[model samples]
Target chain A: MARIIGGLTSSHIPAIGNAIARNLFEDPYWKPFFDGFPPIRAWLDEKQPDVAIVIYNDHGLNFFLDKMPTFAIGAAPEYRNDDEGWGIPTLPSFAGDPRLSWHIIEQLVGEEFDVCSCQEMTVDHGFTVPMQLFWDDWQKKPIRTVPISINTVQHPIPSPARCYKFGQALGRAIASYPSDQKVVILGTGGLSHQLDGQRAGFINKPFDLMCMDKIVSDPELLARYTAHDLVREAGAQGAEFILWLAMRGALQGHVQKLHGNYHVPISNTGAGTMLLENAD
Target chain B: MSTEAITQDIPGTIIFNGEQAMKGYALNKMCYSFNKADSRAAFKRDEEAYMEQFHLNAQQKAAIRARNVLDLLAAGGNIYYLAKFAGIFGLSVQDVGAQQTGMTVEAFKAMLAKQGE
Candidate 1:
């Protein structure tokens, strides 16, 4: 049976992608944020997985208001990055594991998740930034991916409890895959930062820390958070924290958080990253 | 299960739910077109024509014409899509944020720095 090796969670702020593009690491404003990723790069080098299940949101790139899917899974053979209307450097296309994807889709639908199976999808920063953070040169195509997208953009977003439940279903699907491939589940988006309204530059590091603690040790408590509570506490755009619940739900009980990091103002976000290894 | 729970009246923020999604579909579709260089140029060439093509409501047209970020938000323009509109005027989201908060751009940057401290 396929095994879930672990889950990784990180903030997918697009400005970080822009900084990477402009080679801004040596710049003083960026060094602190850039400093956190080298350890992640080294860790991934040690615990390389065959495939990565990337859970991220589409930031007006692939899906628009015309039709939005609350949950979408990439079932294509290859996935590409879109130009996010800001000239952020586009990464190479990601190879998809169709067999694994279809298996998960079958499993999810069987369990009543009703995730939209996407045959073709162009990912935005939410998908690319985390990959870039972990892989020194992600363009080498070292791993295949299944991009799982959830809607935090449109209102009526999935609640934290529902997201965690969906993650648990996802964990079951991954464990039951016919092959022995080792897989990594990644969730990318937020740790308390909003992008709109009169309260635009909102950041709640305390709340973000509260979330990280809950997500690592007591995800169900985090799940108790209503979407309204997330917006109120984590900020409007920071509702992207819902993605982390899905990641937290995917693993078995008591996974050890191997490493973690959090920083603020990564261009209107309190950026955070965490690595959790299943204690199996 | 219904629109009843959406917090649209959360003070100064306009929540973009299914209702707003339908209202701004054409405007957002036009903004999404900015993903390509050609469309950005097409927009820059004839702003009025582009708004006309999108069948933007008078409010949306006025918001676009005046480059008013708050007005756009009230008119159902999602922040991500509005970023494209802001980009044309060389405005970063933080700049837009400053505009929303009624602060000068430099003050917003300083506040962000202070927040980090």
Candidate 2:
């Protein structure tokens, strides 16, 4: 049997990586942002989860503008790091657990989730940005991952209800896995802020706080929201936050808030991070 | 000239151009088609009827009806969605890549290798 040891939600601005790689944490604007992530770092250090089911969206990197799957899962033994033009400074390839990944794949299929499974896939900053913050020496570790890639960048993406249901299904799949491993479900992307023409720098603190509340106490209400509504309120790209509900829905109702940090104007987007322990 | 450019002047067909290329209506249809089990059947039963539901313009409808990947891309159609449409033609993204770039997939791979150097 598997238990969700905890859940983490983080903003994945590529600039954060730039800050880390350049050792610019002491810079006035970047220091607080870097400081905000320590609680998540400490939690991962302590929990040491055996597997991490990372829920994230690809940004026209691996999937490309050619064909995008609504929900794709990476069941490979390892994932290669993608070079999104300028490469990640010192990051190494991510090691994945094939046996556990395959088990979850089988369960998702049995549950009729209709996941797109791949053996040799490359992950972009969507997965790595959070990994860099959560785990120390993550690149060198022998950690296994189950990647759930959502179609966020493209239009006609999965509905919020669909995402929440998928999260519930993933939770069931994880719980039913034969292995006795501790798992951590990471939901990455957004607290608020939108990136696009005219409405480029939009950030709604009230809506973001309301979303945080809905994610924990009332996911059902959040599920009713269309992607259009999120884009309008939080900015177009802000809808990526829907991925968080999948991780939240998979956890126990009550969550222990470990640490949280919120910041704005990071490369034309508002960003935030939150760590939560599942109620046992 | 590219096959797309040649086809753009074809009579009674839509010419995809400029911002219309990124509008994503065709891409949305491609996702909807492949994700739904009965999509192929529905399209086969009545292609125009099925497409009409999207409320696409005359040009979008014509481009989709023509099954033109280049036209779609030119009309602001996303490659991701176009890839799905290519799948319907028993084509892979590599094939579409070759078609769009006017080079063989192998040639493109070699080009990429060179750029990586």
Candidate 3:
């Protein structure tokens, strides 16, 4: 049966995309953030997961406010990136696994977690940036991807608790798939940063640190936070922590944190990265 | 939960709830079109006409004219969509952030850099 090998988390800030495009890894402003990925990349190179389930939030590239789904999953044969009204260069298309996608979608629906399934979806920076970070040369040696976007743009987004449960459902769905395909789950975006209002550049390092630690050892504790609390503590956009929670929920057995890093002021956010392997 | 009851007094933050989404639909719909280069060019060519085509409210238009992030938020603009509107002027999040917080871009960048230290 298909099994989840591990889960990874990273901030999907748009500026990171620009930095990558400009090849600013050694630049002072980007060094710390860029430095977080090499260890995780080494692990990916070793494990070679067949597919990656990327849990990220869309930023107006796919679903808009007109038809926003609280939880949406992409089942396309390929996923592409487009301009997000910003000037970041678009990345190449990602291969998708329809068989696994439909399997998980059916299982999620069967488990009573209604999710909007899309066959044609354009992933934004929130999805693409992390893909680039983890597998910089993904186009040369691509991995099948399944993009699951949670609503972070609109309010009433899924709570940390709800996202955890959804992740648990996802874990079950992946475990049930009748294949030997290895899968990796990526919960992209946020450690704390808000980009609007007077609190536009807000970053809570202590709160982010606490949440990052708890997301590994005691995710249920992080799940206790209401969406409102996340906004208040982590900043409005920092509430993207829900994506990380979903990624954590899918690890079904003894989980070990193989590597982790935390950096601040990555384009006005406390960027975080973690690699947790599941030993079942 | 009621949007106001939940989102009240979150200093310097605006929750993009159903009410705000409904209020800003026309404005946001206009900004969303900026995703396309041609639409962005057209907006740059004649900003008012482009906004008019989307039937933006007086407040939204005024906010757009003022180029004030806070006013745009009050006009029911979500930051993600408003970003497209800001993109037309080549403004980054840090730029709009400085505008909203009344800080110089240098000071704002400094402030962000300080968080790490």
Candidate 4:
């Protein structure tokens, strides 16, 4: 049976893509944010998880308003990235575990999650940025991936508690798979920052700190926040905190916080990065 | 659910719920097309003709014409879609936020930086 090694979280804002492209890590303005990744990369190198499940929100790339799926999973053999109109350089395609994806999909639907499974999906920065952060030169050392997209762009997104439950279902599905593969779950996006309306530059550092702390100790408290409550406290886009909750849910065993870094104003976001190790 | 119940009252924010989605469909569809380089070029060639193709209403057209972020939101524009439109003119979220809040780019950035302290 497959074993879940741990879970990771990173803010997947598009500016991080541009920053990586420009090789701006050492630049003073970017160093604090860029500095967060070395420890994560070192851990990945040591553990070397074979497959990664990325939980992220599609920002108008793969699915638009015409037909938005509340919860979608990628079951393709390979997933590709495309230009999201900011002219950011698109990354190379990522290999997918179709067999494992089908297994998880079957299990999830059986569990009554009713997720949309996609054979073809265009992953945006939300899925790609974290991969870049965790594994530099991902092209040379590739990891098979599965992308789970939650609708955060449009309103009426899934509640935090519901997402946590979905994560728990996902954990069971992965553990039940008949494979020797090791897996890592990545919850990408947000601490707090809004980019719309007159409240565009909103950032709540205190709330963000409370979240990062509680997500490790008491995710139930974080999960208790309604979507509206999250939007009010974490800003509109900051509601992506649910993604982190979903990642947390997948770690059913004893968990420990390995490392964490929080930085402000990364392309109008309160950037957060955390790595949690699981021990059964 | 009642309309008032579904529609949140987050200050300076508009929830892009079903009502806003329905209202902004045409405008958003137009912006979503900007994902393709050729579509962006087509819109650049003739903005008026492009808006016509998307069947954008007067309010949406005016919002696009004015390049006002607040007005665009008032016309039911979701920021994600409007971002593609904003990209045409090389505007980042900071630029839009500055414009909407009536602050210079530096001031808006300063406000964001101060949050960390």
Candidate 5:
């Protein structure tokens, strides 16, 4: 009975948080990034989904080099705002919906997906940055969340095929939920940008556009892409595109682009945003 | 190494080999129960009784039963495996710290300082 309102994909740069906190939206460089996200902002205001299932990769913040999870889902009542070394000027902790999260977990598992469920999980900039951009006064809202933590930081990460399958499982699970509440699936991470070692500051606008095109029309081809392909084209860090596939797959091959935008050189990364509504 | 050799060899290292990895059905079952509304309550009422159904080894069981992050890492578990265990413990690596040393964040910092002494 559950309905997916739509999907939102965005880049999560820590610098964007700094800019927002300092009220530097008018700054020339940051302005383009903010402008690109207007569609997401409008979608959030108009759709107002009951819960947002966010797929993101945590960067050495919640899970470090010591241990990581290829995929972990949050089933907690509330999640505190993390201090990723540098603090977010004045943002409060985010609230979570444990009941709905548990339901989704149960449904997904029933549909035959290997899921890691956590009761007390802290979200890093990957999640908070996107939330800050999409919501108005996110800290104060009663937002329920199902945080899907992807392992993009470490080697031998999930394959594009696997991520897409997980997304399909997620769609099946959400559809199986007995509630009639509306759900929004947000895929946060990248669209061609890399950070780390010599490959830092790589951006492929052609590949980014191609990714957008495939996410909506030719997802089957996207699923066949190996991590090596994404790495070679979009750079290693750009491999976070796997997270976006999960969102695309969840729509079960039904997607309509609401808006799309791309900009580069934001704190040494290419940033982009895309809004998709379920056509099925 | 040539691309073909590297590509073929990669799977053997990460993915479980032989029969160990053939748990697609079991994985699905676990996923289903995990997502259920009464997952926490069900897990709490009879965790051992529930896990017994999995037919995992002592090492696997111990990893899942681990109370913190230290226990998980010390068990020679990978991130995905550790994640399943961490989920059961309701703990994160940030909370548990390194297991072999049993050092808190501050304690670890202190130990580093002692090296300077």
Candidate 6:
């Protein structure tokens, strides 16, 4: 049977993508952020899961204000990287595992998730930054991937409770796929940092730290936080961290928190990364 | 502002919720177009003409002209799309954030550095 081997969560800040594109790992400003990845790379090398179900939100890339899906799954064989204006360096196209994607799509529909299916979609930094940070050779020795785009950019986004439940349902689907495959899920974007308005530069370190702690131990406790509260506390953009709840919910039993890294001011974000192994 | 327009009660931060979406549809659609190099070039070549094509209101045009991040927010600018607009002026997200907070980029960087320490 297919199993979720593990899950990862991180802030997919665009600056991280810029740093990776420019090879700034040794630079002091980016050192702390880059330093966190070696251990993660080692873990992936050790586990070597067959696929990564990347859960990310589009930043005005594919779906626009015209018709935005709260939850969409990529069922394509290959997904393209989008031009998130100002022209961030483009990464190589990602290879997708359509078999696994369709399987999950069937299961999610059976569970009443009502997710949109995207046969063709281009990804933004939210999809690529985490790949660059952890799967450094993703372009060459690329792991097969499935992109699950969530709506965090537009308002009326899915609730934290709903996202968590969706993760739980996803966990069940992954566990029952009836294939001998291992999978890793990524929940990308934010710990705390607002990018707009009078509260710009907002980064509540205490709140971010609390979130990290809760994510490791009692992630469901965070469901109590309304989207309004998340905006108020974690900052506007930082509320995208709700995507982490889906990752947190996907793991079976307890998760062994393997490694975690948190750094501040990575281009208007309190960036964080964590690797969790499902306790089987 | 439309009386029926939706507004979040959050102090200081303008939440880009549904009401703001309706209010800023034209500006955002124009910003979304900035994703293409041709559109970005056209915007740079004739800023006034581009604004007119987007049918931006006086407030949005003034905000775009002044490069005021706060004014853009009040006029319903979503930051993700506006990042493109900011890039035209060589303003990083941090630079725009500093502008919104009424701090110079240096002071803002100092504030961020202090948080890490």
lDDT of 3 by residue, A126-170 (tens): 899999999987999999999999999998889999999999999
| Proportion of the native interface contacts kept in model 4 | 0.74
User: RMSD of candidate 4 to the true fold?
Assistant: 1.0
Candidate 2 regions with alpha-carbon error over 4 angstroms: B1-117
Fnat of all models, as shown:
0.57, 0.00, 0.74, 0.74, 0.00, 0.69
Q: Name the TM-score of candidate 4.
A: 0.99
**lDDT of the structure predicted as candidate 3:** 0.92
Cα lDDT, model 1, residue A91? 77
TM-score of chain A, every prediction, order shown = 0.97, 0.94, 0.99, 0.99, 0.94, 0.98
- DockQ pick, better of 1 and 2: 1
Q: TM-score for model 1?
A: 0.96
Give the best candidate by lDDT.
4
Docking quality category of candidate 4 according to DockQ thresholds: high
Residue-by-residue lDDT tens digits, candidate 3, B8-97: 669888888888899989988988898999999998899899989999999999998998889889988988988988888888888988
Models 1 onward score TM values of 0.96, 0.71, 0.98, 0.99, 0.70, 0.96
**Local accuracy of candidate 2 as per-residue lDDT tens digits, A1-280:** 8888888888876557767788887898677677887778777878888888889988645675446788889978778764443334536777788877777778878888788888878887788888888885776666678888998866567778888988888888888887788999999888665433223244677787787766766888998997767766676567888899888878864677777766654544556778888867
- What candidate 4 gets wrong by more than 4 Å, as runs, is none
| Model 1 misplacement above 4 A | B1-6
lDDT of 5: 0.68
Model 5, A1-280: lDDT tens per residue?
8888799888887668888888887888578888877667777778778888989988645665435577888988877655443334436767787877787788777767667888988887788888888885665666677888998865677899999988988898888788887888989988765432223334677788788888888887998999867777776567889999999889964678889877765654557788989956
Candidate 5 DockQ score? 0.02
lDDT of 4 by residue, A1-280 (tens): 9988999999998888888999999999899998988998999899989999999999999999989999999999999999788798877899999999999999999999999999999999999999899988789989999999999999789999999999999999999999999999999999898999888899999999999999889999999999889999999999999999999999998998999999997988999999999889
For candidate 4, give the DockQ. Answer: 0.83
TM-score of chain A of 3: 0.99
Worst 10 residues of 3 chain A by lDDT: A83-92
Which of the predicted structures, 4 or 5, would earn the higher TM-score when compared with the native? 4
Q: How accurately is candidate 3 docked according to DockQ?
A: 0.81
| Candidate number of the best DockQ | 4
